[model samples]
Target: MQKLLIIDDNDEVRRQLKWGLSKGGYELTFARDGVEGLNMFKKQEPSVVTLDLGLPPHENGVEEGLRCLGEMLRINPLSKIIVITGNEEHGAALKAVQGGAYDYYKKPIDLNELKIIIDRAMYLQTLEQENQDLRDSSVADCGIVGECGTMQEVFTLIDRVAASDVPVLITGESGTGKELVARAIHAKGPRADKDMVCINCGAIPENLLESELFGHEKGAFTGANRTVKGKVEYAEKGTLFLDEIGEMPMSLQVKLLRFLQEMVITRVGGRRDIEVDVRIIAATNVDIQEAMQNGTFREDLFYRIGVVNIVLPPLRDRGADIALLANYFLKRVSAGAGSRGKAFSPEALEYINGYDWPGNIRELENRVKRAVIMATGPQIEPDDLGINGGDVLRQRLHANDLSLKEARMLLERDMVEDALKRESGNIVKAAASIGVSRPTFYDLMKKHGVRNA
Candidate 1:
């Protein structure tokens, strides 16, 4: 049942609202003052709250009531708080509304009218909650699964930048799912209904890159038989994803910058300047700074498309997300392949956690798919994943025949040392790679008597 919290100090007022709002099909809770009301609000987590501005110990003033309203809203910003006030305190009622109250009710409340407002507020709150849930679910379904802090930060950035029309530049190492991030932004944005045109800047030859982006008129080139639209034209009213944008030829960068600045494009061998509205999302595996310094990439164009930059971390640095993604991929690939479902063996899981994924998520997914196809047994082994002898921790633990606590201590120390070695003794990078804070990493190093070179 929907919860309704009534925060009026007056005994008669609370009774009246309780009786009237009870008929609205709600679970009603009442508080005589702001403190009690806030406590009830937190406990009940009511979708709708009816706050009385004339609350004690200064019932004649609206300070206590306003304070309660602010605190409740702070706890749950989506809370629908309806403020009740006296006819003489019209200004206070307005002030309450300005302070984020859902609505304001005046003196001499009519039960039916107040019920209507309360019902509306409850309905809107339900809708907002549903929308939030849908967004969260959609993001998960997009194959960008990760629970690590860095991945969570990337997800937050995707949500924030998806709502705007500004150009986005995604940078990461090769096979780190830069394109996946781009697609997530496009899929969640307002332009999702429209086509998301994609073009790989590096995959295409330099001689034809311009024609591919800006279209070519009939007979413009040796093989031009008819006029054709380009990727930018097809992406009108939508998004254009330029994969490997760092590889875009310097000659074409000036043209892309022009179109970005003016929102107009001219086809090859065509005189007409076509105005196309499209958001640009570019991704690259190259270091953009180095490219710019070498004069291979334009600095102005970089700033133009990189209004917001989303940098994806390498898979090795994402800690436990490596195992999380591996399992996620196994389940998905196995299901898609019409298999009864396959799991990773303990040794395989250990290997997955231990091995460095230089190729990032792309490499993990490919290995999982290959394993599903190659494995004859129900559980995939490290050999099936093509990573032989990677489970050193598992082997070491089994060989020693140590107690559970000893095994755990040994595993922790080995993981710390391995991460440090993989990261070349960079404490910050090593700590983050193993999903621990720098201080915790330091403690582990001290506990194990491990020295860094």
Candidate 2:
């Protein structure tokens, strides 16, 4: 049952409320003063609270009541506290709201009207709690979150390629999760039971890379004290994820190409050739076509590795996926860190959607992680995110040389998203906020492909 706490100083008024709310189906508790009421609030932890503005120690004023209200909110910002005041106390009521009260009620309370207000407050509180719980429990698909059309196509391609042994070359900008794609393919492929060995071509020293790829025999070099299997041999009958393959030196590229063709490798000081059965999955943030043009990458090796390609779109171009990913990261990081439930302010969301994410997913995760730690309130403002809303539009305009029509469309889409967010996903209120008819708002939403909240 939902808990409700009623705080009032008048014996007559408390009696009247008790009679009116007895059949409201609530687990109700009552107190005659701010001190007693606050104690009950802390002990019972009620979801909805009705606080009378005239309590003892200031039974004729709202000062004591407001102080109690502030304390209750401080203890639990999600709690719903409704202030009950007199008809002439409109200013005090507004002040209560500004101080974080959920809503205000006037004196001479009618049982039916008060019950309706109480019911609405209970419903909103439940809704917010359910949402927070859902976010806490929700999981992303395959450790990835994407709902846009382009991402759907990418998902389809990943499934198709995971069923084959053909080499897959994943291309994307840095921080765009190229390695994640490779791992997903390996995880879903026929070699799922086998180990998926990974090596970054650029991260290793050039002189040692060849040795690392093809194991060396005992006495092969000063440090080669014993025979060891290289990545290929270790990944036998599995997958070898060669990250930053474009960074491999030309000499090593020839060796890799030879291994791909013959499925055999000779140790550095051994004459016998060993055959290994392994699938290759390469990833690079560089442009292989440009590298090949400059004599840095080999065309023959490209064909050997790029039998199939999966290109990941950058965060900025992924449409609504940007917000989807931001929320996913927020939930994931918040749950893991054991932080209080929180959400992004509408302005902060606007900035997030408008800003150009040059660093893509990695940057977004880092920002959200930091904001989770830095935020002091229930809502993460743009300042907490280290973003300036005013600068977002300017940065976007300068980053993309958009046409006049494209710019207008961008603004329209942003306005539509911002209105929906500010209005708490209420379609009617969102439409009214932007001075548009509901049908027109729906049309604009459809044109921009903005999903309903």
lDDT of 1 by residue, 8-102 (tens): 88899988887777778899999999889999998999999999988889989989999999999999998899999898899988888998999
Residue-wise lDDT of candidate 2 within 126-169, one digit each (tens)? 76785565444322234766767877778788889999999999
Provide the global lDDT of candidate 1 against the true structure.
0.86
User: How does candidate 2 fare on TM-score?
Assistant: 0.61
Best TM-score goes to which candidate? 2
**How many clashes in each candidate?**
0, 0
Q: After best superposition, candidate 1 residue 235: deviation in angstroms?
A: 0.2
Runs off by more than 4 Å, candidate 2: 1-141, 388-390, 397-453
Off-target runs (Cα >4 Å) in candidate 1 are 1-140, 390-453
